[model samples]
Target: MSIKGKVAVVTGSAQGIGRGIALRLAQDGADICLVDMQIEKLQGVAEEIRKLGRKACAFQCDVTNRSQVFEAVDYAEKELGGFDIIVNNAGICITKPLEKISEEECERIFKINVFGVLWGIQAAAAKLKANKKKGKIISARSIAGHTAWAMLGMYSSTKFAVRGLTQAAAQELAPFGINVNSYCPGIVDTNMWTEIDHGCAPEKGVATGETWKASVAGIALGRAEKPEDVAAFVSYLAGPDSDYMTGQSVLIDGGIVYN
Candidate 1:
């Protein structure tokens, strides 16, 4: 599973699951390019990767922008000496009843969660092909993608869109030896979950923490997910061990939403 001396670009790497993936890849012997709008926090992650004895570069980027996404890939290859992996992990979660979903809210979530991944795929694929190298393109999906929750309908739709993109891109890029896949996480203990919990609380007529607790109770693993749990699976996808695996929207959500 060694990815030693490889270069990887991880978006939304300033915190949460993205940060975990970036650090794990570095610890496993890959130089990293940390991409996020949070420049200060991104630099902090870069410092941590450097401490792990891996080269790291922090690039401020808005993944929703096609031009910026392309630029980031180019910058990563130039600074890190090569590009072999890309994790399109930047996304926003929206919680609302289907009828209550406004057009603007729908667009906002899709732009970040869906279009961002598409742009990352395009940019990474173009770069890899230009360099005549094969690479991995990973994106963030969710258990909601597999099983659409009522209050999270919009967010679920975006994730489902990502799954479609992953499958299609995998087929299209396979001829070039490029693999494209997505990771589906469930009830992670991150700020995103905090938002989900709070958003569901009002609809459930319960306190914020209660919604979160109830959701976790359904997990067969009997615990809320940690960033490292998702990171571990992502590490496999980013490494050579998963070279033969592509077009998979894998659920790393304990035992929930089994496909």
Candidate 2:
């Protein structure tokens, strides 16, 4: 499972699951290109990767921007000397009922969650094909993607779209030896989950913390998901062990929404 001497680009790597994935990849001996709009936090993650004895570069990028996504890949290949894996982990979650989801909100989340992954697939495939290298393209999905939940219909829709993109891109890029897959997480103990809990609190008529507790109540593992849990799976996806796998939107949510 070693990815030693490979180079990887991880988007939204400034915090949470992205940060965990970047660090895990570095720990597995892959040089990293950390991409995010949060420049300072990206630098911090880069420094941590450096401490792990892996080359790291911090590149600020808006994943929703097609050109910026392409440039980020270019920068990664140039700075890290190769591009073997791309983890399109940058995404935003919106909590709103389907009935009340406005046009603007729908567009915003779709741009970040759907279009961002699309551009990532495009950029990564292009680079890998040009270099004649086999690689992996991973993206972030959610449990909502597998089964739609209340107040997260629109968010779920975008994730489902990501699953579609992953499958289609996998087939299209298979000829080039590029694999496309996604990770589906649930109830992660991250700022994003905190935001989701808060958003559900008002509708559920409960306090913020209570909503989060209610959510964790359904987990078979009896605990909230962690960044490391997801990172561990992503490390496999980015390594040789998963080379035979593609177009899979795997659920790493402690047995939640099992498929």
lDDT of 2 at 252: 94
Best by lDDT: 1
Worst 10 residues of 1 by lDDT: 250-259
Clashing pairs in 2: none
**Superposing every Cα of model 2 onto the true structure, what RMSD results?**
0.8
Taken over the whole model, the C-alpha lDDT of each candidate is 0.94, 0.93
lDDT of 2 by residue, 1-259 (tens): 5999999999999999999999999999999999999999999999999999999999999988999999999999999899999999998888878888889998899999999999999999989999999999999999999999898899999999999999999999999899999999988999888899889898878887997898899899999999999999999999999989999999999877979
| TM-score for each of the candidates | 0.98, 0.98
Candidate 2 Cα errors over 4 Å, as ranges: none
Model 2 earns a TM-score of: 0.98
